[model samples]
Target: MSRMNRFLYSLADGLKGILRNLMMSLMSFSMLIGSLLVVGSLSLLVVNIDAIIQDLGDQNEIMVYVHEEYDDSEFNQISQAIMEAEHVVGFTFVSRETALEEMKNDLEEYASILEGMEQDNPLRDGFRIQVDDPANVEAVVTAMEGVDGIGNVEARTDVVESFLKTRNAVNLISIGLMVLLAGISTFIIMNTIKMSAYTRREEIAIMRMVGATKGTIRLSFVTEAMIICLCGSIVSFFAIMFLYQELIEKAFSSTGLLQAVPFQEVWGGVLLIFVGASLVIGVLGSLLSINKYLKV
Candidate 1:
Protein backbone atom coordinates (compact mmCIF):
# COMPACT_ATOMS: atom_id res chain seq x y z
CA MET A 1 0.00 0.00 0.00
CA SER A 2 1.09 3.61 -0.66
CA ARG A 3 2.01 5.66 2.41
CA MET A 4 -1.20 7.71 2.10
CA ASN A 5 -3.29 4.56 1.78
CA ARG A 6 -1.60 3.09 4.80
CA PHE A 7 -2.39 6.24 6.78
CA LEU A 8 -6.04 6.10 5.75
CA TYR A 9 -6.27 2.44 6.71
CA SER A 10 -4.86 3.12 10.17
CA LEU A 11 -7.22 6.03 10.67
CA ALA A 12 -10.23 3.93 9.72
CA ASP A 13 -9.10 1.18 12.05
CA GLY A 14 -8.82 3.67 14.95
CA LEU A 15 -12.36 4.96 14.41
CA LYS A 16 -13.69 1.41 14.24
CA GLY A 17 -11.90 0.51 17.46
CA ILE A 18 -13.51 3.44 19.30
CA LEU A 19 -17.05 2.70 18.07
CA ARG A 20 -16.78 -1.04 18.66
CA ASN A 21 -15.85 -0.47 22.31
CA LEU A 22 -18.71 1.93 22.95
CA MET A 23 -19.24 0.78 26.53
CA MET A 24 -15.56 1.22 27.40
CA SER A 25 -15.48 4.58 25.67
CA LEU A 26 -18.41 5.81 27.77
CA MET A 27 -16.75 4.57 30.93
CA SER A 28 -13.51 6.31 30.06
CA PHE A 29 -15.39 9.51 29.28
CA SER A 30 -17.15 9.46 32.64
CA MET A 31 -13.89 8.95 34.50
CA LEU A 32 -12.18 11.72 32.56
CA ILE A 33 -15.01 14.16 33.34
CA GLY A 34 -14.87 13.44 37.06
CA SER A 35 -11.09 13.79 37.17
CA LEU A 36 -10.94 16.89 35.01
CA LEU A 37 -13.74 18.57 36.98
CA VAL A 38 -11.86 18.30 40.27
CA VAL A 39 -8.60 19.37 38.66
CA GLY A 40 -10.21 22.38 36.97
CA SER A 41 -12.04 23.50 40.10
CA LEU A 42 -8.85 23.39 42.15
CA SER A 43 -7.03 25.35 39.44
CA LEU A 44 -9.70 28.07 39.56
CA LEU A 45 -9.38 28.21 43.32
CA VAL A 46 -5.65 28.81 42.96
CA VAL A 47 -6.30 31.58 40.47
CA ASN A 48 -8.70 33.26 42.89
CA ILE A 49 -6.14 33.15 45.67
CA ASP A 50 -3.53 34.71 43.41
CA ALA A 51 -5.98 37.50 42.53
CA ILE A 52 -6.68 38.06 46.21
CA ILE A 53 -2.97 38.35 46.84
CA GLN A 54 -2.60 41.02 44.15
CA ASP A 55 -5.55 42.98 45.55
CA LEU A 56 -4.12 42.77 49.05
CA GLY A 57 -0.82 44.09 47.81
CA ASP A 58 -2.62 47.14 46.45
CA GLN A 59 -5.37 47.78 49.04
CA ASN A 60 -3.73 46.77 52.32
CA GLU A 61 -0.58 48.45 53.58
CA ILE A 62 1.29 49.33 56.78
CA MET A 63 1.62 52.90 57.97
CA VAL A 64 4.70 53.83 60.01
CA TYR A 65 4.04 57.13 61.78
CA VAL A 66 6.99 59.36 62.61
CA HIS A 67 7.37 60.83 66.11
CA GLU A 68 5.72 64.24 66.43
CA GLU A 69 8.96 65.94 67.53
CA TYR A 70 11.08 64.38 64.77
CA ASP A 71 12.48 66.97 62.29
CA ASP A 72 11.54 66.59 58.62
CA SER A 73 15.19 65.87 57.70
CA GLU A 74 15.22 63.06 60.27
CA PHE A 75 12.88 61.12 57.92
CA ASN A 76 16.08 59.93 56.17
CA GLN A 77 16.81 57.87 59.30
CA ILE A 78 13.38 56.23 59.15
CA SER A 79 13.72 55.54 55.42
CA GLN A 80 17.14 53.98 55.95
CA ALA A 81 15.77 51.80 58.79
CA ILE A 82 12.88 50.64 56.63
CA MET A 83 15.32 49.75 53.85
CA GLU A 84 17.03 47.38 56.23
CA ALA A 85 13.76 45.86 57.43
CA GLU A 86 12.77 42.45 56.17
CA HIS A 87 9.67 41.99 53.94
CA VAL A 88 9.39 45.70 53.09
CA VAL A 89 8.79 45.95 49.38
CA GLY A 90 8.14 49.65 48.98
CA PHE A 91 7.45 52.83 50.97
CA THR A 92 6.38 56.43 50.39
CA PHE A 93 6.70 59.43 52.68
CA VAL A 94 3.39 61.22 53.30
CA SER A 95 4.19 64.74 54.55
CA ARG A 96 1.89 66.30 57.15
CA GLU A 97 0.55 68.62 54.43
CA THR A 98 -0.22 65.67 52.13
CA ALA A 99 -1.88 63.76 54.98
CA LEU A 100 -4.09 66.74 55.75
CA GLU A 101 -5.12 67.04 52.15
CA GLU A 102 -6.00 63.32 52.06
CA MET A 103 -8.10 63.70 55.19
CA LYS A 104 -9.90 66.65 53.64
CA ASN A 105 -10.68 64.70 50.53
CA ASP A 106 -11.84 61.56 52.38
CA LEU A 107 -13.78 63.36 55.12
CA GLU A 108 -15.38 66.04 53.00
CA GLU A 109 -18.31 66.17 55.44
CA TYR A 110 -15.81 67.00 58.20
CA ALA A 111 -13.90 69.50 56.08
CA SER A 112 -14.39 72.10 58.78
CA ILE A 113 -12.86 69.81 61.38
CA LEU A 114 -9.76 69.28 59.20
CA GLU A 115 -9.55 72.99 58.34
CA GLY A 116 -9.72 73.80 62.03
CA MET A 117 -6.71 71.52 62.54
CA GLU A 118 -4.80 73.38 59.81
CA GLN A 119 -3.52 75.76 62.49
CA ASP A 120 -2.31 72.66 64.38
CA ASN A 121 -2.41 69.76 61.88
CA PRO A 122 -2.19 66.89 64.36
CA LEU A 123 -1.50 64.47 61.49
CA ARG A 124 2.11 63.38 61.61
CA ASP A 125 4.52 62.67 58.75
CA GLY A 126 4.51 58.95 58.07
CA PHE A 127 5.74 56.28 55.73
CA ARG A 128 3.15 54.24 53.82
CA ILE A 129 4.72 50.77 53.84
CA GLN A 130 3.90 48.05 51.37
CA VAL A 131 4.72 44.56 52.51
CA ASP A 132 6.04 42.30 49.77
CA ASP A 133 4.04 39.38 51.07
CA PRO A 134 0.70 39.36 52.84
CA ALA A 135 1.73 36.30 54.84
CA ASN A 136 4.65 38.24 56.31
CA VAL A 137 2.60 41.27 57.39
CA GLU A 138 2.98 40.34 61.03
CA ALA A 139 6.72 40.16 60.72
CA VAL A 140 6.87 43.42 58.81
CA VAL A 141 4.67 45.13 61.40
CA THR A 142 6.86 43.93 64.23
CA ALA A 143 9.92 45.25 62.49
CA MET A 144 8.26 48.58 61.72
CA GLU A 145 7.62 49.21 65.41
CA GLY A 146 11.37 49.27 66.08
CA VAL A 147 12.31 51.91 63.49
CA ASP A 148 14.18 54.76 65.22
CA GLY A 149 12.09 57.74 64.09
CA ILE A 150 8.78 55.91 64.11
CA GLY A 151 6.30 56.67 66.91
CA ASN A 152 3.75 54.01 65.94
CA VAL A 153 3.25 51.35 63.27
CA GLU A 154 -0.30 50.58 62.15
CA ALA A 155 -0.86 47.42 60.12
CA ARG A 156 -4.18 45.65 59.73
CA THR A 157 -2.67 42.35 60.78
CA ASP A 158 -6.11 40.88 61.37
CA VAL A 159 -7.09 41.09 57.72
CA VAL A 160 -3.72 39.88 56.43
CA GLU A 161 -3.74 36.95 58.84
CA SER A 162 -7.19 35.92 57.63
CA PHE A 163 -6.01 35.80 54.02
CA LEU A 164 -2.90 33.89 55.03
CA LYS A 165 -5.03 31.17 56.59
CA THR A 166 -7.21 30.98 53.49
CA ARG A 167 -4.19 30.74 51.18
CA ASN A 168 -2.75 27.85 53.15
CA ALA A 169 -6.06 26.03 53.22
CA VAL A 170 -6.59 26.37 49.49
CA ASN A 171 -3.05 25.18 48.73
CA LEU A 172 -3.58 22.08 50.82
CA ILE A 173 -6.93 21.44 49.13
CA SER A 174 -5.38 21.73 45.67
CA ILE A 175 -2.64 19.22 46.41
CA GLY A 176 -4.97 16.73 48.08
CA LEU A 177 -7.64 16.94 45.38
CA MET A 178 -5.12 16.59 42.56
CA VAL A 179 -3.66 13.43 44.03
CA LEU A 180 -7.09 11.92 44.69
CA LEU A 181 -8.42 12.69 41.22
CA ALA A 182 -5.32 11.33 39.47
CA GLY A 183 -5.64 8.06 41.34
CA ILE A 184 -9.33 7.73 40.55
CA SER A 185 -8.82 8.52 36.89
CA THR A 186 -5.92 6.11 36.62
CA PHE A 187 -7.85 3.30 38.25
CA ILE A 188 -10.88 3.73 36.00
CA ILE A 189 -8.84 4.16 32.83
CA MET A 190 -6.69 1.11 33.54
CA ASN A 191 -9.76 -1.08 33.91
CA THR A 192 -11.47 0.31 30.85
CA ILE A 193 -8.35 0.00 28.70
CA LYS A 194 -7.83 -3.58 29.81
CA MET A 195 -11.37 -4.45 28.76
CA SER A 196 -10.90 -2.67 25.45
CA ALA A 197 -7.69 -4.53 24.72
CA TYR A 198 -9.32 -7.82 25.66
CA THR A 199 -12.34 -7.41 23.37
CA ARG A 200 -10.13 -6.39 20.47
CA ARG A 201 -7.61 -9.14 21.10
CA GLU A 202 -8.56 -11.04 17.96
CA GLU A 203 -8.42 -7.96 15.79
CA ILE A 204 -5.14 -6.95 17.34
CA ALA A 205 -3.80 -10.46 16.78
CA ILE A 206 -4.93 -10.45 13.13
CA MET A 207 -3.27 -7.10 12.49
CA ARG A 208 -0.04 -8.29 14.00
CA MET A 209 -0.05 -11.48 11.88
CA VAL A 210 -0.90 -9.65 8.65
CA GLY A 211 2.32 -7.58 8.34
CA ALA A 212 0.96 -4.86 10.68
CA THR A 213 3.70 -3.33 12.87
CA LYS A 214 3.13 -3.17 16.63
CA GLY A 215 3.38 0.63 16.47
CA THR A 216 0.44 0.78 14.07
CA ILE A 217 -1.80 -1.31 16.33
CA ARG A 218 -0.79 0.68 19.41
CA LEU A 219 -1.43 3.98 17.58
CA SER A 220 -5.09 3.10 17.04
CA PHE A 221 -5.72 2.49 20.78
CA VAL A 222 -3.84 5.63 21.72
CA THR A 223 -5.93 7.65 19.29
CA GLU A 224 -9.10 6.35 20.91
CA ALA A 225 -7.75 7.29 24.36
CA MET A 226 -6.94 10.80 23.14
CA ILE A 227 -10.42 11.18 21.69
CA ILE A 228 -12.03 10.27 25.01
CA CYS A 229 -9.78 12.69 26.92
CA LEU A 230 -10.46 15.57 24.50
CA CYS A 231 -14.21 15.09 24.87
CA GLY A 232 -14.01 15.04 28.66
CA SER A 233 -11.76 18.10 28.75
CA ILE A 234 -14.21 20.05 26.58
CA VAL A 235 -17.11 19.09 28.80
CA SER A 236 -15.19 20.04 31.93
CA PHE A 237 -14.26 23.41 30.42
CA PHE A 238 -17.93 24.33 29.96
CA ALA A 239 -18.80 23.09 33.43
CA ILE A 240 -16.08 25.30 34.87
CA MET A 241 -17.45 28.30 32.97
CA PHE A 242 -20.90 27.77 34.48
CA LEU A 243 -19.43 27.30 37.95
CA TYR A 244 -17.32 30.46 37.73
CA GLN A 245 -20.31 32.48 36.55
CA GLU A 246 -22.34 31.27 39.50
CA LEU A 247 -19.52 32.18 41.86
CA ILE A 248 -19.29 35.69 40.38
CA GLU A 249 -23.00 36.25 40.83
CA LYS A 250 -23.51 34.65 44.23
CA ALA A 251 -20.19 35.45 45.88
CA PHE A 252 -18.35 38.35 44.23
CA SER A 253 -21.40 40.50 43.47
CA SER A 254 -21.89 41.09 47.17
CA THR A 255 -18.22 41.46 48.13
CA GLY A 256 -15.95 43.80 46.26
CA LEU A 257 -12.93 42.61 48.21
CA LEU A 258 -13.10 39.34 46.30
CA GLN A 259 -13.50 39.86 42.58
CA ALA A 260 -13.60 37.17 39.95
CA VAL A 261 -10.91 37.25 37.29
CA PRO A 262 -12.77 37.58 34.03
CA PHE A 263 -13.08 34.18 32.34
CA GLN A 264 -12.06 35.57 28.99
CA GLU A 265 -8.75 36.75 30.43
CA VAL A 266 -7.69 33.34 31.79
CA TRP A 267 -9.81 30.62 30.15
CA GLY A 268 -7.70 30.24 27.04
CA GLY A 269 -4.56 29.46 29.01
CA VAL A 270 -6.46 27.24 31.39
CA LEU A 271 -8.01 25.34 28.49
CA LEU A 272 -4.66 24.87 26.85
CA ILE A 273 -3.14 23.41 29.96
CA PHE A 274 -6.18 21.26 30.68
CA VAL A 275 -6.21 19.77 27.20
CA GLY A 276 -2.47 19.13 27.32
CA ALA A 277 -2.62 17.39 30.68
CA SER A 278 -5.61 15.27 29.71
CA LEU A 279 -3.97 14.22 26.46
CA VAL A 280 -0.74 13.28 28.19
CA ILE A 281 -2.60 11.19 30.75
CA GLY A 282 -4.80 9.55 28.13
CA VAL A 283 -2.06 8.74 25.60
CA LEU A 284 0.56 7.67 28.10
CA GLY A 285 -1.86 5.68 30.21
CA SER A 286 -3.13 3.77 27.17
CA LEU A 287 0.38 3.19 25.78
CA LEU A 288 1.46 1.72 29.12
CA SER A 289 -1.65 -0.30 29.93
CA ILE A 290 -2.21 -1.68 26.45
CA ASN A 291 1.37 -2.98 26.27
CA LYS A 292 0.73 -6.30 28.05
CA TYR A 293 -1.66 -7.31 25.27
CA LEU A 294 0.50 -6.24 22.34
CA LYS A 295 3.75 -7.74 23.64
CA VAL A 296 5.31 -5.23 21.20
Candidate 2:
Protein backbone atom coordinates (compact mmCIF):
# COMPACT_ATOMS: atom_id res chain seq x y z
CA MET A 1 0.00 0.00 0.00
CA SER A 2 1.07 3.59 -0.64
CA ARG A 3 2.16 5.67 2.42
CA MET A 4 -0.86 7.97 2.05
CA ASN A 5 -3.21 4.98 1.84
CA ARG A 6 -1.62 3.41 4.90
CA PHE A 7 -2.01 6.65 6.86
CA LEU A 8 -5.68 6.89 5.97
CA TYR A 9 -6.21 3.21 6.81
CA SER A 10 -4.60 3.72 10.24
CA LEU A 11 -6.82 6.69 10.96
CA ALA A 12 -9.89 4.66 10.01
CA ASP A 13 -8.78 1.88 12.32
CA GLY A 14 -8.33 4.43 15.11
CA LEU A 15 -11.89 5.66 14.71
CA LYS A 16 -13.12 2.07 14.76
CA GLY A 17 -11.20 1.41 17.92
CA ILE A 18 -12.85 4.37 19.64
CA LEU A 19 -16.29 3.11 18.62
CA ARG A 20 -15.42 -0.42 19.69
CA ASN A 21 -14.57 0.84 23.15
CA LEU A 22 -17.11 3.62 23.40
CA MET A 23 -17.66 3.39 27.14
CA MET A 24 -13.94 3.56 28.01
CA SER A 25 -13.37 6.40 25.54
CA LEU A 26 -16.25 8.42 26.99
CA MET A 27 -14.95 8.00 30.52
CA SER A 28 -11.50 9.22 29.45
CA PHE A 29 -13.07 12.13 27.61
CA SER A 30 -15.12 13.24 30.62
CA MET A 31 -12.14 13.05 33.00
CA LEU A 32 -9.95 15.04 30.59
CA ILE A 33 -12.54 17.81 30.29
CA GLY A 34 -12.87 18.12 34.05
CA SER A 35 -9.09 18.28 34.50
CA LEU A 36 -8.66 20.91 31.81
CA LEU A 37 -11.38 23.08 33.31
CA VAL A 38 -9.74 23.09 36.71
CA VAL A 39 -6.33 23.85 35.23
CA GLY A 40 -7.67 26.63 33.00
CA SER A 41 -9.63 28.23 35.82
CA LEU A 42 -6.54 28.31 38.05
CA SER A 43 -4.50 29.82 35.22
CA LEU A 44 -7.07 32.59 34.67
CA LEU A 45 -7.16 33.42 38.36
CA VAL A 46 -3.37 33.85 38.46
CA VAL A 47 -3.42 36.01 35.34
CA ASN A 48 -6.05 38.37 36.76
CA ILE A 49 -4.27 38.64 40.10
CA ASP A 50 -1.04 39.61 38.37
CA ALA A 51 -2.90 42.20 36.33
CA ILE A 52 -4.41 43.76 39.46
CA ILE A 53 -1.04 43.89 41.16
CA GLN A 54 0.51 45.60 38.14
CA ASP A 55 -2.25 48.23 38.05
CA LEU A 56 -1.80 48.92 41.76
CA GLY A 57 1.95 49.34 41.31
CA ASP A 58 1.44 51.75 38.44
CA GLN A 59 -0.85 53.99 40.51
CA ASN A 60 1.40 54.06 43.60
CA GLU A 61 3.72 57.00 44.30
CA ILE A 62 5.66 58.65 47.14
CA MET A 63 4.97 62.09 48.59
CA VAL A 64 7.98 64.01 49.96
CA TYR A 65 7.24 67.16 52.00
CA VAL A 66 10.03 69.70 52.26
CA HIS A 67 10.66 72.14 55.20
CA GLU A 68 8.67 75.42 54.86
CA GLU A 69 11.84 77.49 55.51
CA TYR A 70 13.46 76.31 52.21
CA ASP A 71 13.59 79.04 49.50
CA ASP A 72 13.60 78.48 45.68
CA SER A 73 17.32 77.63 45.44
CA GLU A 74 17.00 75.30 48.47
CA PHE A 75 13.85 73.74 46.97
CA ASN A 76 15.64 73.37 43.64
CA GLN A 77 18.48 71.57 45.50
CA ILE A 78 15.92 69.30 47.19
CA SER A 79 14.30 68.47 43.82
CA GLN A 80 17.71 67.65 42.39
CA ALA A 81 18.44 65.39 45.34
CA ILE A 82 15.07 63.58 44.90
CA MET A 83 15.73 63.02 41.18
CA GLU A 84 19.12 61.56 42.03
CA ALA A 85 17.68 59.09 44.59
CA GLU A 86 17.84 55.34 43.90
CA HIS A 87 14.83 53.78 42.13
CA VAL A 88 13.45 57.29 41.48
CA VAL A 89 12.18 57.35 37.88
CA GLY A 90 10.89 60.92 38.10
CA PHE A 91 9.46 63.61 40.45
CA THR A 92 7.14 66.62 40.18
CA PHE A 93 7.37 69.54 42.64
CA VAL A 94 4.06 70.99 43.94
CA SER A 95 4.34 74.41 45.58
CA ARG A 96 2.20 75.34 48.59
CA GLU A 97 0.22 77.82 46.45
CA THR A 98 -0.63 75.18 43.86
CA ALA A 99 -1.58 72.71 46.63
CA LEU A 100 -3.97 75.27 48.24
CA GLU A 101 -5.60 76.01 44.89
CA GLU A 102 -6.07 72.27 44.21
CA MET A 103 -7.60 71.78 47.70
CA LYS A 104 -10.04 74.66 47.12
CA ASN A 105 -11.09 73.25 43.77
CA ASP A 106 -11.57 69.76 45.24
CA LEU A 107 -13.78 71.25 47.98
CA GLU A 108 -15.58 73.59 45.61
CA GLU A 109 -18.77 73.80 47.76
CA TYR A 110 -16.66 75.33 50.57
CA ALA A 111 -14.36 77.35 48.31
CA SER A 112 -15.45 80.66 49.87
CA ILE A 113 -14.39 79.50 53.35
CA LEU A 114 -10.77 79.16 52.14
CA GLU A 115 -10.69 82.30 49.93
CA GLY A 116 -8.54 84.29 52.38
CA MET A 117 -6.10 81.45 53.33
CA GLU A 118 -3.74 81.88 50.35
CA GLN A 119 -1.43 84.28 52.30
CA ASP A 120 -1.29 81.79 55.19
CA ASN A 121 -1.34 78.58 53.07
CA PRO A 122 -1.31 75.61 55.46
CA LEU A 123 -0.01 73.22 52.71
CA ARG A 124 3.76 72.63 52.49
CA ASP A 125 5.93 72.30 49.37
CA GLY A 126 6.37 68.69 48.26
CA PHE A 127 7.39 66.38 45.40
CA ARG A 128 5.35 63.51 44.01
CA ILE A 129 7.96 60.84 43.20
CA GLN A 130 7.44 57.83 40.93
CA VAL A 131 9.45 54.69 41.60
CA ASP A 132 10.74 52.19 39.06
CA ASP A 133 8.97 49.23 40.77
CA PRO A 134 6.47 48.74 43.57
CA ALA A 135 8.77 46.18 45.21
CA ASN A 136 11.41 48.92 45.55
CA VAL A 137 9.09 51.58 47.01
CA GLU A 138 10.35 51.02 50.53
CA ALA A 139 13.91 51.47 49.32
CA VAL A 140 12.95 54.67 47.51
CA VAL A 141 11.10 55.93 50.60
CA THR A 142 14.15 55.25 52.76
CA ALA A 143 16.39 57.08 50.28
CA MET A 144 13.99 60.07 50.26
CA GLU A 145 14.00 60.32 54.04
CA GLY A 146 17.81 60.75 53.99
CA VAL A 147 17.68 63.67 51.54
CA ASP A 148 18.58 67.08 53.16
CA GLY A 149 15.74 69.67 53.67
CA ILE A 150 13.07 66.96 53.25
CA GLY A 151 10.85 67.00 56.34
CA ASN A 152 8.81 63.80 55.77
CA VAL A 153 8.31 60.99 53.22
CA GLU A 154 5.03 59.11 52.77
CA ALA A 155 4.21 55.92 50.81
CA ARG A 156 1.61 53.09 50.69
CA THR A 157 4.10 50.42 51.72
CA ASP A 158 1.49 48.26 53.51
CA VAL A 159 -0.79 47.97 50.50
CA VAL A 160 2.04 47.20 48.09
CA GLU A 161 3.48 44.55 50.42
CA SER A 162 0.11 42.87 50.84
CA PHE A 163 -0.45 42.64 47.07
CA LEU A 164 3.03 41.26 46.46
CA LYS A 165 2.48 38.57 49.09
CA THR A 166 -0.85 37.58 47.56
CA ARG A 167 0.66 37.26 44.09
CA ASN A 168 3.38 34.91 45.33
CA ALA A 169 0.91 32.75 47.25
CA VAL A 170 -1.43 32.41 44.28
CA ASN A 171 1.41 31.44 41.92
CA LEU A 172 2.59 28.69 44.25
CA ILE A 173 -0.90 27.31 44.76
CA SER A 174 -1.71 27.31 41.03
CA ILE A 175 1.49 25.47 40.19
CA GLY A 176 0.76 22.79 42.78
CA LEU A 177 -2.80 22.29 41.57
CA MET A 178 -1.85 22.09 37.89
CA VAL A 179 0.85 19.51 38.58
CA LEU A 180 -1.53 17.36 40.60
CA LEU A 181 -4.26 17.51 37.98
CA ALA A 182 -1.91 16.70 35.10
CA GLY A 183 -0.63 13.64 36.93
CA ILE A 184 -4.13 12.34 37.66
CA SER A 185 -5.25 12.95 34.07
CA THR A 186 -2.23 11.16 32.64
CA PHE A 187 -2.83 8.12 34.85
CA ILE A 188 -6.52 7.81 33.94
CA ILE A 189 -5.76 8.17 30.22
CA MET A 190 -3.11 5.50 30.45
CA ASN A 191 -5.55 3.03 31.99
CA THR A 192 -8.23 3.78 29.38
CA ILE A 193 -5.82 3.06 26.53
CA LYS A 194 -4.57 -0.04 28.28
CA MET A 195 -8.10 -1.42 28.56
CA SER A 196 -8.73 -0.71 24.89
CA ALA A 197 -5.54 -2.56 23.90
CA TYR A 198 -6.42 -5.53 26.10
CA THR A 199 -9.86 -5.87 24.50
CA ARG A 200 -8.28 -6.00 21.03
CA ARG A 201 -5.47 -8.38 22.01
CA GLU A 202 -6.59 -11.06 19.54
CA GLU A 203 -6.81 -8.59 16.66
CA ILE A 204 -3.39 -7.09 17.50
CA ALA A 205 -1.84 -10.55 17.64
CA ILE A 206 -3.29 -11.46 14.23
CA MET A 207 -1.88 -8.23 12.71
CA ARG A 208 1.54 -8.99 14.18
CA MET A 209 1.39 -12.51 12.70
CA VAL A 210 0.53 -10.97 9.28
CA GLY A 211 3.82 -9.00 9.37
CA ALA A 212 2.44 -5.65 10.53
CA THR A 213 5.14 -3.18 11.60
CA LYS A 214 5.30 -1.97 15.24
CA GLY A 215 5.14 1.67 14.09
CA THR A 216 1.86 1.06 12.26
CA ILE A 217 0.24 -0.52 15.33
CA ARG A 218 1.56 2.27 17.54
CA LEU A 219 0.22 4.97 15.18
CA SER A 220 -3.35 3.61 15.28
CA PHE A 221 -3.45 3.53 19.07
CA VAL A 222 -1.79 6.96 19.42
CA THR A 223 -4.19 8.48 16.92
CA GLU A 224 -7.19 7.11 18.78
CA ALA A 225 -5.99 8.52 22.08
CA MET A 226 -5.11 11.89 20.56
CA ILE A 227 -8.53 12.26 18.94
CA ILE A 228 -10.22 11.67 22.28
CA CYS A 229 -8.00 14.18 24.08
CA LEU A 230 -8.32 16.82 21.34
CA CYS A 231 -12.12 16.69 21.56
CA GLY A 232 -12.01 17.14 25.32
CA SER A 233 -9.54 20.04 25.10
CA ILE A 234 -11.59 21.94 22.49
CA VAL A 235 -14.81 21.47 24.43
CA SER A 236 -13.18 22.48 27.70
CA PHE A 237 -11.71 25.61 26.15
CA PHE A 238 -15.09 26.93 24.96
CA ALA A 239 -16.85 25.89 28.16
CA ILE A 240 -14.35 27.77 30.33
CA MET A 241 -14.56 30.83 28.13
CA PHE A 242 -18.34 30.94 28.32
CA LEU A 243 -18.27 30.51 32.10
CA TYR A 244 -15.56 33.17 32.42
CA GLN A 245 -17.55 35.71 30.37
CA GLU A 246 -20.63 35.04 32.45
CA LEU A 247 -18.61 35.61 35.61
CA ILE A 248 -17.26 38.91 34.29
CA GLU A 249 -20.71 40.17 33.38
CA LYS A 250 -22.57 38.98 36.46
CA ALA A 251 -19.94 39.64 39.15
CA PHE A 252 -16.96 41.76 38.11
CA SER A 253 -18.69 44.30 35.85
CA SER A 254 -21.11 45.63 38.46
CA THR A 255 -18.45 46.22 41.11
CA GLY A 256 -15.51 48.61 41.26
CA LEU A 257 -13.96 46.46 44.01
CA LEU A 258 -12.36 44.06 41.50
CA GLN A 259 -11.29 44.09 37.87
CA ALA A 260 -10.79 41.07 35.63
CA VAL A 261 -8.42 40.70 32.71
CA PRO A 262 -10.47 40.41 29.55
CA PHE A 263 -10.72 36.89 28.08
CA GLN A 264 -9.91 38.18 24.57
CA GLU A 265 -6.46 39.27 25.72
CA VAL A 266 -5.60 35.74 26.93
CA TRP A 267 -7.72 33.23 24.96
CA GLY A 268 -5.07 32.65 22.30
CA GLY A 269 -2.38 31.67 24.76
CA VAL A 270 -4.84 29.60 26.79
CA LEU A 271 -5.94 27.67 23.70
CA LEU A 272 -2.37 26.91 22.78
CA ILE A 273 -1.64 25.60 26.26
CA PHE A 274 -4.69 23.35 26.30
CA VAL A 275 -4.04 21.89 22.84
CA GLY A 276 -0.37 21.38 23.53
CA ALA A 277 -1.02 19.69 26.86
CA SER A 278 -3.67 17.42 25.33
CA LEU A 279 -1.34 16.23 22.57
CA VAL A 280 1.47 15.51 24.98
CA ILE A 281 -0.74 13.65 27.42
CA GLY A 282 -2.35 11.65 24.61
CA VAL A 283 0.94 10.52 23.13
CA LEU A 284 2.49 9.71 26.47
CA GLY A 285 -0.50 7.72 27.69
CA SER A 286 -0.84 5.72 24.46
CA LEU A 287 2.84 4.79 24.29
CA LEU A 288 2.99 3.59 27.87
CA SER A 289 -0.17 1.51 27.43
CA ILE A 290 0.86 0.01 24.10
CA ASN A 291 4.33 -0.92 25.25
CA LYS A 292 3.13 -2.70 28.39
CA TYR A 293 -0.24 -4.17 27.33
CA LEU A 294 0.30 -4.91 23.60
CA LYS A 295 4.09 -5.07 23.65
CA VAL A 296 4.06 -3.02 20.37
State every prediction's TM-score relative to the real structure. Answer: 0.85, 0.90
Highest lDDT: which candidate?
2
Model 1 poorest 10 in a row by lDDT: 249-258
As a whole number from 0 to 100, the lDDT of residue 86 in candidate 2 is 85
Candidate 1: where is the Cα deviation over 4 Å?
Answer: 1-7, 83-89, 108-122, 246-250, 254-257
Question: Per-residue lDDT tens digits of candidate 2, residues 1-296?
Answer: 57788789778988888898889889888988998998898888778877877887787799999997988798888888887788888888888888888898899999889988977788898998988888999999888888889998899999889988987888888789778877777887888788878888887888788888888788888988999999999999999999999986357767977778889999998899889988888899888888754453
C-alpha lDDT score of every prediction, in listed order: 0.79, 0.86
* TM-score of candidate 2 to 2 decimals: 0.90
RMSD per candidate (Å) reads: 2.9, 2.3
> What is the per-residue lDDT of model 1 for residues 79-130, given as tens digits with 9 covering 90 to 100?
8988888888888999899999998999999787666787888889898988
The most accurate candidate by TM-score is 2
Clashing pairs in 2: none
RMSD of 1: 2.9
Q: What's the true lDDT of residue 230 in model 1?
A: 87
